[model samples]
Target: MLSLGVRQLDDILGGGVEEGSSVAFVGSIEYDNVILMHQAVLEALKAGKRVLVVDFRQPPSTLLKELRNHGIDYEPFLDDSLTILDGYSNLYGQGIQGGRNVLPNPLDLGITTAIIREALQGDEYDILVIDDVTSQYTLQSSPKIYIKAVVRLVNSVKSLGKTTFVAVCSDVFEKSDLAAILIPFDYVVEVSKGVVEVKRSLQPLRVVEPKFAYMRTRNGISPMKEHYQSLEGLKAQLRAGENGTIWLKDLRVQILEEVTERSLIETVYDFLGPEKGKELLYTWGKKQFIGYGEYSKRHNTSIEEALEDIFKFTIASGGGKLELVELSDSVIIIRGTNLFPSGKGYPYPFHPNYAGSLAQFLTEFTGERWEGEETKCEAMGAEHCEFVLRKVR
Candidate 1:
């Protein structure tokens, strides 16, 4: 199987396209099928696989130039690993000057079929891509002839144990005719507007809903997720004096591990002294709270909702088991079990800086100065840890 290079799309494709499989991409004008094909070609080349691309939209030189403009280095792979079947030049009675395999009469189904079969005879290619297969019907007498030629070519490549992708415009042929033509393919995907939907597939028995939106980046095209869109929206808001979400575990790990060599408790005590360390930790927590506050404001969510997410993130990161016992306009109380406490007869009952961090976070989140105290402690021979935050007037 060949990876599509897009993780989510690959998952939807039942772990990528298998060799000898026929996949069709039916795209509307709003969708850029060539870009998708380009991405696939780049991926195949990167995997050190021999690729044969039959270009129907543009001359081989034009295609190579476009690939270069997209930051793809086609020089090293040309002729050796990557081959292009120039279909555009022949249609206009132009002689192929570039070192490309000329499809003498691309409009003729018989000749095109013969050339494709001859090229695939040696099993030299891992992938055979026919870009814009609909272009073959441009001057044809009947769509049936072009359809038969496509099916034959795909089957021929399949017989050679090679993967084939045939791209076609969704609106080019009548609905019934298009369905009939696509019926022979193992997979049929439709790209319309910005959404990519699986119209037909042999595997991935259960299809996922909310068809993916394709997003193009410097690297290439990939399926975009809702969270990613949300992040972008949030980023726009932040740029306009707003805010958003953070990967809490990554932040926590960075602070607790990368930022310091000592343990969370020891670092706080030695660097800032117990009294100052608590204040510093509280300030750090407040910054985190403030960041989340902006996200809540922009998202039209309650501060408590943001806090719930923070609590969930903390627990998920194995910080400890934290429970929100009480939450109000004026005060908040949370109880934690297995809270990281200093081991073996340490002076503190719990990590002092952690208490400070929690205090500041609550203070900023509530828009008021809040004093936090660890009323119950595990290090002090208590069963669990409890933190109480009281509004400080």
Candidate 2:
């Protein structure tokens, strides 16, 4: 219903960009966050707002033109409402360059911010775009400097009700630090590879906010076709028997330290749908991260060549779905994203479990008896274990 002007993205983000907010685009992701910034600027422009694009990475013209190919219309910017700062950084390691010339080179200032500020000082723009926050973080002095820069730049534009989108991808290298800068923004849109996902980081309106969810690419990268078959309209094949290739167009795999009936398959999806239940299984081998060599030794497998060969597994039909397998009494089994060979009878926690645990860590889920869920203590050579895990849900 709303418009960011980026067709599908606007739909995904639920309307246009919020007036004044900073969206940190994590660079490490296959989808470069900076590219999203460009899209935001183009969106603001289509909304008839003057946009300022400060690019420490590249010239706005080039970047803007690039956006044109990716579904953003830039004719308006060519008509003037958009301004891009070009080559504003001379701070290449041993030197610091301002507007005029290279300085004595202590590298105390982030030239990008200054260029943006000066540009904005003259015009009453409605939206501001910072190509990226990485250059500044890499060149600037400390975290305090970055925070102050972001706060000042963000608040300054916000006072005028102008929306600002700053692309900072290098933040993933330091999550604790990113939390400080990114958590303050009202809306966040991350573009990875071809996937565009949005989250309401700090919503002021509070009407409706988006949560973090998995994004899949269909037509190209990251996003499935709008009219593509619904998740339910698919089949899956987990086992390698009569159902040679079980079509699991919408297969959702889960993992845990110890595969319990609860954690193994918490809920049964509607099997009537084309893609019903296609779950992968694994165990939480150990909580600690010992080196691969040591880990392999502890599990009686070569650190280099380890997989489903050394695990136990079982499959049963549930809700009419074929592959409803569970890894009972196991640990360190790989699942989800194929980070490792994960399946039933495995002896280690799967990728999905690690991911869930990671999510638990990020969201700070409730603390419950996770270790106690499957075992009283680590039963030595025992069988059929059951334990309760305290989770935040």
Candidate 3:
């Protein structure tokens, strides 16, 4: 038996999870299912089990950092007890080299299968951790094909007497589709609305009566008594997950499209003219900030705290790293590094979207109308972007 490291969860599972059984963690990103995966990994490692992590979400390095941040000593097990199959770099076409198990092409099912087989050859790993199964849908032409592939992979792992722990975002699937996907797993754990329940249990079947409720903190999961103290505290556990979705409490935001920095700039300039395009982009940014500000106010969050939270959210979503350089009654200055929306080779200053965002951030925070301008931009040969917001009139 492999323990999940949580006492209540273990008892619910009839002491512990069965070996060679495939367990599916079904949930949306807000529930911190990824942390559950990390906890399982730590437990498996402590039990002297060699683990294989097939990551399809983020860069393996970033995943490792998060695992470490959760206080899991994964580094010591690296290349020996732990081997990560990086599916992120190749899937995104970065082709980053120097990983033990780097996929040449993640979209190719055959390559993916062969790589996992190679890693599992000779009973090398006792546990298989697929950080997520939802990402496979993005690679396949049809959902039916990917579900078959998942079943095949799970069956193959079980054949080697290895355990499988996989995560699936329940929100991304239809009710029928989710049921179909869960059919292969021996155990299905559903995490939703701060409740962890055993949705399916075939191996020595047991019921989780009264459903286990838990609150996730930075350290780890804790069994909740009655209810969460703060809704905003729950919202603070933001995560970017499967299908390019960002979760904030119950809100699900999807990234609809991807455009290159230069193309976005040129297209806007050509379609709307530079001045109108800039104005439109600025309004877009301001609208985004205003919506967030309103949401924060509704939650009874202080403006200062809301500003900091938005900055962190921006960085987490790959917007950029922002630092408050200066703040006074009349002026606010923000320094941005590696701003994702800014192009490096442009001949002129080009970050009106960010400038507009800064203006709205100030206007909403201070209750004073503000105008913002980009004083320094990487597009204009500056090392970083600087936005200066001054009170209007």
Estimate, for each residue in 1-393, the C-alpha lDDT of model 2 and write its tens digit: 214434445433544545555555555544446545555565567767787666665444566566655666666565388665544344443354454322223234555456456556755566677666665666555766676677777776666556677776753437766766765566766655444556554433222223222333221222333222233212222323343443233443433343354343333223322122222221233232214223323222221122221121111222111111232332222222212222354333223333333223222211221222222111222232222333232
Q: What C-alpha lDDT do the candidate models reach, one value each? A: 0.66, 0.44, 0.75
The candidate that achieves the highest TM-score relative to the unseen native structure: 1
Candidate 2: segments with Cα more than 4 A from true spot: 5-14, 27-29, 59-69, 73-76, 87-115, 170-172, 193-197, 201-222, 225-393
lDDT of 3 by residue, 16-42 (tens): 788989899888967367777678778
Report clashes for each candidate as comma-separated counts. Answer: 0, 43, 0
For residues 215-317, write the lDDT of model 1, one tens digit per residue.
5544445554322334342232232212543342123112244224236756776787867765666555555544544333332235565566556555544
Clashes of 2: 43
Top-lDDT structure, candidate number: 3
Q: How much is 84 displaced in model 2, in angstroms? A: 0.8
